[model samples]
Target: MRILYGVQATGNGHITRARVLLPALRAAGVEVDMLFSGRQPDRLFNMEPFGDYRTCRGFTFVTDAGRVRRLGTLKQSRPLQFFRDYRCLDLNGYDLVLSDFEPVTAWAARRQQVPSLGIAHQYAFYHRIPGTGSAPLLKWSLQLFAPVDEAVGVHWHHFNAPVLPPLVAPSPYPLTEEEGKILIYLPFESMDEIRYLLRAFPEYRFRIYCNIPAPETQGHLEFEPFSREGFQQDLCSCAGVIANAGFGLCSEAIQAGKKLLVKPLQSQIEQRSNAVVLEQMGLGRVMPSLETEAVEDWLALGSGTPSPWPDVATALATWISTGRQVPIQVLTRELWRAESGNMLSLC
Candidate 1:
């Protein structure tokens, strides 16, 4: 069957999920085409996997310092262009459209009456997941942002919901802990602030991955431009991870068995909720903002046990390929059961 896959490029998490699933889907003998939106074409990198993917000017949030700037986000949105893209997106030969919180493909699927499925962490909030109530309008906008015929939410825990486990690939690098080494990936925060905060802990080495133009080291801290291969190598060896509470990175950290300290983007409900769930599961530590005290407290603690989640990408792809005749509850139960008693349910 032919499928059109839509990915939101505003954040790396959506793309990360797609990265894990695309291979699995192809292995399942499904033909697929990828479309990405919500960020400038020049900004995307390490994207050889998608293979000549199409792009559109999609909606995105604007952030300053560490918080979402509502006015700026509004100013950045191109509703007319979005509508045109939506109307212009041709879905003639696609049997199904799979969306990772991408509005254009979802809307096009809706307008053309093509079957659509949303598969992303954001869909988890559709259920009674944690960290969802802070911004009511933001919460309400989820459905309007990307509506689909069916949605499969992905998260660390099922929370007694139909959500599946995080779709992360096994570490390509052999997992090994390097003492006194930590990986930092807070892209939303100011680089200068990160340098200042991390400089206080000269005892530990920080490998920061950001939008830097070049690689440089400042005393104990090493700054590198974003590279998936380099980042994965660091992730495999680092004793711990310090990053924004984006679902993808945190999931990778948990899979790699690294201790996690996350600073959620202020007013972003998804990250806040993700932090809450991480705390609830005793999987990681959360800080409201960038602060020395929070980092100090986290560093003093021992590493949490890795969840070592099962290969969910393969499982989901198999299910989707065979036909989604099986109930979501059945799929959820089996995947969680495969976790070897790692599942933590709130319901």
Candidate 2:
């Protein structure tokens, strides 16, 4: 079967997910082609998994110091170019189209009358999941941005919905936790600001990765560029993780049993919702902004227990191979039972 998978490049989560899912699909004996959008093609790294992928100038949100800059995003969107790209896109030969919240292929499939499936965390919002910060505008954007048919949502938990577990990168480095070692990945925040906020915590060592042009370090805080190998190594070594409330990183941290603290992007519904669910499940802590108080409070608390999650990538591939629809309840129950009994749902 031929598949055209669309991934959003605005954040690393979709890219990270593709890194695992693509290989699983290939192993299932399915031919897959990936179309990535949002960031420039040159900016992407560790792309060997996609294997001769295609890129397009896709729409992306602009952010400034942990908050979405609406005006800047509006100014940056090339609507005419987007319309042209939409019209020019061809999904004629593909048997199925799958999107990870990518607008290009989703819209293309909608217009061309091709079968489309959305497989991403964002789609979880379609159901009554744990969520907060609901604005009609952002809600509308989420719906219209990536329109699809018969969607499948992935989350840290099923939330008694059709949602499956998050698909994460396999542990590349063995878990050798270093006490007081923290991995900070707040890409949307200012470097100087993150540094300033973290300076007070001199007792702890931080390995921070952002969009730095080069690698550098300051005192106890180490700054590095986007390196998948280096990040995984540090993630494996660190005792905990401090990052933006992105599902990708938080999911990885949870799966690895690392203590997690997240600062959700301002005015972002998905992020706020993620934070709410995480906190609700007692899996992690959330800070409203880059405020030091929340950090102080979080640091005072002990690390939460890590919950074992199923290998969702392989399961998804197997499910896709079988045409019959299996309920997520059945899928999660069997997979979780097979993987580990120490579930956070135990609480």
Q: Name the runs in model 2 displaced over 4 angstroms.
A: 136-140, 324-333, 336-340
**lDDT scores in order:** 0.90, 0.84
The digit string of per-residue lDDT tens for model 2 on 1-347 reads 88999999999998999888999999998899999999999899988867889999989999999999999999999988888887799997998888999998999999999888888888877777667435545546667999888777888766667777788866777877788888999999998899889988999999999887898978999899999889999988888889989999888898788888999998788898889988887778888878888777777777655555668899989887675388756876766455446664422
Query: Which ranges in model 1 have alpha carbons more than 4 Å from their true place?
Result: 135-139, 343-347
Count: clashes, candidate 2: 0
Best by TM-score: 1
What is the C-alpha lDDT profile of model 1 across 225-247, one tens digit per residue? 98989999999999899999999
Poorest lDDT segment (10 consecutive residues) of candidate 2: 338-347
Tell me the lDDT of candidate 1: 0.90
- Per-prediction TM-score, please? 0.97, 0.94
